[model samples]
Target: MELTTLWFLIVGVMLIGYFVLDGFDFGVGMALPFLGKDNTDRRLIINTIGPVWDLNETWLIVAGASLFAAFPEWYATMFSGFYLALLLILVALILRGVSFEYRHQGKGEQWTRWFDQFIVWGSVVPPLLWGVAFANLVQGLPIGLLPNGGWIYEGTLLTLLNPYGLLGGVVMVLVTFTHGLVFISLKTTGDMRERARALATKVGIGAILAGAVFLVWTIVMHLDHELLWLIVTCAAIAALALIGGFVANLAGREGWAFTGNAVGIAFALLTIFSALYPYLMYSTIDPAFSMSIEGAASSQKTLELMTWVAVFTLPLVLAYQAWTYWVFRKRLTRETITAGAH
Candidate 1:
């Protein structure tokens, strides 16, 4: 494959990693009010993801950096166009990370509650905005090229608040919420585990419903694309995976449930990226103004150099993250939390 296409796939892989890993982290955070019945329950829930939430977040950083490096023009157009939305996501992430650290350091219960709220909002905002943002990308943006070859976004933030975009946000929220519940079920024991599993089954239905609409909308929008079949296949698999996850959760199989949801999330993303192939950013302003992958990518030499660096570093990063998860693999319990044995 050409370097430009390779980098596009690499960027897609990094994004899929972010969604698959941090997606559950987002799920766990959003689940706070639902699953956490008491301070002990809350702490147990938090501790389930405490060890690796930040680590999972690293994939976003890598994805962003890779986007900037591999497709500078695409990066520029998206960052500038989605500036306000991205800023909100950034602030939410920072607040969420801070809440994770400072919630325990509070002097009193009220202080901790404040941070807990932050954690919940922080988890909720990013995924919703991310969904809106990506949905807009698939739906096409009002972007146009300038005389100087610069790109300009002709729409405002409010323009992204359309029905389709909002539905995309809702779908993401439901998917991640269910994903987190499954994670909780996978990583906890006794009543909490069973509660999480039950909740996941309930929420997974919403995820399936909303995800079906969003994916169908996406496929319909791209019916003229040469890769329509790829998009359709991915969307079909995503729907099945989500239903399979719901069934697995019902059957008392937390591991398979989590895996199924993860696969669902991954293929949902694959459906989007597959639809978005060739054009990094589609232009609703004018089809001629859309940013193609070749038009937006960095030079061949830069891509080749970055590919070499990734070849050396990517495996090591994967190995270290795997080891970290393995080391913290034991299920958490309220008894353990009460016994101070995190």
Candidate 2:
């Protein structure tokens, strides 16, 4: 494969990793206001994700760094075009992470409650905005070529708030919320698990409707007829997986339910990245201004060197993270959470 194509897949893999890990984290955060009826309940909810939320987030950093190094032009144009939106996502991430750490530093209940609010909003905004951001990026941006061999983004924040962008935001937020509910059902036991399962059933239905709309819209707009069947196949699997997840939750098969939900989430992301193949960013203003893998890539030497570095280090990183999850694999209980709370 060409180095440019290789880096595109690598970057795509990293992004998928981020979504799989942080996707559940976002779900858990969005659930706080719903499942956490009391302080102990909230504590239980938080504890489910508390051990590894930060670690899950590192995938996003890795993905961003990879994008910056391998495809600077794509990064440059995307970041500049989505400046305000990206800033908001950054702020939300900080608040969400901080809430996990500082909400228990001998602070009062009120302080914790306030921080919980922050956590919820923090979780809420990013998925929504990310949906919007990615939608706008894929729907195409007002990017243009300069006189010199450079690119410039000529759109404002308002440009990204178009209907399709906003719909993308809503779809992601709902999807993550349901994904978290499934996770909660799996990792928690007793009343909290039951509540999570119940809520997930309801949320799952809405998620299916919203997700179906977005999935169909994506296929209709971006995919070519030759490859249409392939994307449609992925979308079908996603729909089935989501339905299975909700059904499994209702049947008290929590692990199976979580797996189904996770599979759906993965396929959903795959559909998007696959639709974006060849082109990193398509310029709405002019197709000639579109950025593709070959156009945006760094020097061949840079890619070759990075490939060697990745060959040595990436496996170790994945192994260590997998080990971390294995160590923390046991389910959380209301008793455990209450004990920690006291």
Candidate 3:
């Protein structure tokens, strides 16, 4: 494959990784109130993800860096156009991270309780807004490319709040919530496990319905035919996976349930990528000024060098992640949390 194509593949993989890993993190955060009815329940839910929450976020860093290196023009345009939304996401993430650590530092329930709310809000907003941002990115925005090649956003924040964007946000929220419930089922036992399984089953069904609606609306907007087919296929697969996971969870097959949720997210992300195939950014006002993979890529030599660098470094990152998971593979329990190891 050509260097540009190779870079696209790498970036695509990175995004898939982000969706799979962080999808569950966001899911768990959303599930906190539902799965954790009391302090003990909350501790158990939190403990299930404590060891790996930070690690799961590394995929985002990799995705961002890859975009900057391989598609600098796209990055520049998107960063500038979606500056406020990105800023809000960054603040939410920071709040989530800080809350995770400091929430447990105090003995008072009020102190930790307030921070727990922050964590939930932090987790919820990012994915929802990100979906909206990506939906707008794919749907097209009012932007223009200058003679010197820099891009300008002619629309305001309200422009990103269209029906399609709202649909994307809701889909993402439901998808991530289901993803976390599956993980919680797999990583905990006893009451917490049962609660998580039941919740996962419920959220899985909701996600399937929401996803279907989003797919129909997306097609109704008259996207490219090939892209529409690809997205429809992916959406169908995701819906099927969600139903399969719900059935498996009902049957007490935790592993199968988790696998189904993972597949669901994989297909959902594929649907997003399919819809955004050639264009990184579309223009609502002028189709001629839209940015495509070819127009956004860096120089041939730069891409070639990055490909070589990715070859050596990507495996090391994967290995480290594997090691971390292996080291902390034990199921989380109330006893473990009460012992203060969390």
Model 1 accuracy (lDDT, Cα): 0.93
Off by over 4 Å in 3: 227-229
* lDDT of all predictions: 0.93, 0.85, 0.83
In terms of TM-score, the best-performing candidate is 1
In model 3, state the lDDT of residue 126: 92
Residue 339's lDDT in candidate 1: 37
Expressed as tens digits, the lDDT of each residue in 205-278 for candidate 3 is 78889888876776666465566777788878987887888788899898898788788878877776777777
Q: Clashing residue pairs in candidate 1, if any?
A: none
Q: What lDDT tens digits, residue by residue, belong to model 1 across residues 232-276?
A: 999999999999999999999999999999999999999999999
Q: In candidate 3, which residue pairs get closer than 3 Å at backbone N, Cα or C atoms, i.e. clash?
A: none
- When summed lDDT is taken over every stretch of 10 residues in candidate 3, the lowest stretch is 218-227
Order of the predicted models by lDDT, top scorer first: 1, 2, 3
> For residues 1-342, what per-residue lDDT tens digits would candidate 2 score against the true structure?
999999998987888778778988999999999998888888888888887898889989988998999999889888887889999999999999888887876558899888899999999999998999887766788989988877888989899899888888888888888888888878888888889989988888898898898888888896564566767888888889988988888899988988888888788877777777778887888999888789899999999999998899899989999998888888888778644462
TM-score of each: 0.98, 0.95, 0.95
Q: Which candidate, 2 or 3, would have the higher TM-score against the true structure?
A: 2
What is the C-alpha local distance difference test score of candidate 2?
0.85
Task: Name the runs in model 1 displaced over 4 angstroms.
Answer: 338-342
- State the TM-score for model 1: 0.98
Which candidate number would show the highest lDDT if scored against the true structure?
1
